[model samples]
Target: DIEIHVHPFALSYCSHGYRPQEVLPFTGSMGPFFNVFCATIVSLSLWRIRNPKLLPLLMWAGTAYIAEGVAMFIDIAGLPILTDWGKVIIIGGVSPVIIGILGIIFVTIGSIFMLLLMPLENVSHRDSFGKKYLITTSISFYFLLSVIYTSIFVLFVLDNRLIAFFSSIVFSLLLTTIYNPIFPFLDRLSHTKTFQIGWSEVKIALGSAFGIVIIVLVFF
Candidate 1:
């Protein structure tokens, strides 16, 4: 469960306040344009780059940005439906909050993992066992990160500041314990060939999806 606090003035247009209906449209209209602009610059920069080492980091950043933009649009689309529904529904209907949180989590964790694995991209050659190990390790890491982050988010949403603080400390300890052993194994696996090639394919797919998103947002 999560609680969101919106300023009263944000809902209604006060003399000095913003209104959602007006503001959302303006921001929504600009969001894709801004993303496209940034992406174009990034694409051009990548094209001109001579170094192969920088590719992973650049691609990771671009993909993460595109993912975040897509997630934002998802949340935006869900907002009106959420207002109509008047409450959160997990099973039967869409929940903007849950969806949004999920998007954030995926983008954050995926980007972090990509960064962690970037150094291994050049050295590792894809193999059957390596791919399986990569997939399993990725899933496990993602689940752990989700739990740690979501627990903190829930505590804050529940307005349990004190508990959240303590939980953060506990989670940090737990994370260190889990991460220390796994990292060495991950590093070894990375040298033997991880899923870097697969990531390239995924990046291409995401780029195509982003283009489609832009088309939809602009025309429909």
Candidate 2:
């Protein structure tokens, strides 16, 4: 039952226009692949955090990103149990509930870490945006992406687009506030041309791939 409700909204979104069983393959494949990508992002952020050249704020941002990625991945990784039994590779007797609990732990720790790393003293506008402003913007953008996905789930799966839109606004506000403090660490990190260019490319590539996957599922 945990699996049934894990990403109930997401599953609903992807299953639109198809029988429940029909969408399992698409959801199953997409879920794990996206989660693996999250794991990669977490690893990369942690690696960036280890670089001494980066400022303390940037390192904190990396740590927060890692927490966010890990939390999402943990939840997504549990999908195989229900979607594809043949691929259900349990980890030392761990259950879906246990993994969900672990994800919650990561979220709590990440939220606290961001709060601790807030550069309240450095509120001046060193970059195009002030520290707090940058953090708020970054969190808002990320939350918006999340809202898009959740809204799709609610709209298609739950057949309540109106409620989904309103709920997404509230969810985005809450999540953005939760991570607002730690985003300024990016100001220092973004100074590197290599990082800026590379990150932009990475985002574009991932976004394109995600769109392609969705189109494939919906039309084919």
Candidate 3:
């Protein structure tokens, strides 16, 4: 399972020592929704790697995605920079820990893959796949976030709509800004097409595990 440790801030606000499940249980409504939601987000992040052309738009939209993921991750674990190794730097590149060890690996591999497929220049012939995928995926992310955010707004009206909305905004900004600097380093790794071959299969395996978790959560 995805073990999460909560932030200290939550402890001050809520009377309990922070725990992942208490803050965001992956069962009931959140189970199925997050299952579908994170899968889409993962697919979106893998954009340029899958089709070299779509890098621009996918990266543009990834800004928001990186924010959402990081924001929630922070709300859970505070500054994840405290993770093992503190920080990692290399002769050729660097990786800032955005969430945890897994996050570092995900972005690292993604950057390598995307960088491999990077265009030598702004070549026009390579634009078709990029444009088509971006349009389709961005629209999908928007649709899902829109419905999810709006529902959170309406359903939680009795409690704290303001925090919820602000949380969404923070999430948007966090996802975008966090990934921008990291991409270049990943590019430097120079593992584009080959990275995708391994990463995609891993994604499929992880996704299967996620689906089973969701099913178990919902039923058991």
Candidate 4:
């Protein structure tokens, strides 16, 4: 059974002198969370492609961002941002509730950045390194923060310093190595509209979705 495998893994973890102060909480309604993300992405992509005019682009962009921002706040509002607003009551909504909101916002912001980098009908200085550098910075920051969070999570869950540090360093380095050189290369491909939100874009989206699926399948 899967529990048998997980049990030894848990026991081996305890034997290694790692333990959690408290078991991590369960996430509720994961399916809805996934639905929101996929639907939101699809909506935003459709909005982008359908808007031949700039006004339509801005309208949809603003609407999407506001929707995503509201979603993120639903989770984060209780995490010290605005607990008094009664968001943390926990009577409703999904697990890692904050992640539900945050993940979508990340995608939303990512879409906005893409729009900025390649405005609907203009080609001024977007090809310049100066412009793309900002986008690069945003992405690198996400990678770095993600690695740090992973490290803390590893330490908390598995309770093995060696494994935690090893994984963190190795993973962070790998991400950096691949990420550092990938931006400008990706930026170059943006000259053509066909590849704008095509293969490369889908690769990132599907990779994220697949990762979530793997995690849920492996864990709770």
Off by over 4 Å in 3: 1-69, 72-146, 149-154, 157-184, 194-216
Predicted candidate 2 versus true structure: per-residue lDDT over 86-181, tens digit per residue: 132242334556555655665554444443333422332334333444553444444455457756555543333334345434533554554434
**How far in Å is the alpha carbon of 210 misplaced in model 3?**
6.4
Collision pairs in model 3: 53-130, 54-130, 63-176, 66-175, 67-171, 67-174, 67-175, 67-176, 68-171, 113-192
TM-score of candidate 4 relative to the true fold? 0.29
Residue pairs clashing in model 1 are 125-193
Backbone-clash count (model 1): 1
- Tell me the tens digit of each residue's lDDT in model 4 across 36-115: 55655665576545432322223334334433444454546446432212232243333455555565675455444344
TM-score, per-candidate, Cα-based: 0.33, 0.33, 0.28, 0.29
Residue range 155-206, candidate 3, lDDT tens digits: 4432333453455444434433433355466555533432233455446544
The true-versus-predicted C-alpha distance at residue 58 of model 3, in Å, is 16
lDDT of 3 at 192: 43
> In candidate 2, which residue ranges exceed 4 Å CA deviation?
1-93, 108-155, 158-220
C-alpha lDDT values of all predictions: 0.42, 0.42, 0.38, 0.41
Q: What is residue 27's positional error in candidate 4, in angstroms?
A: 19
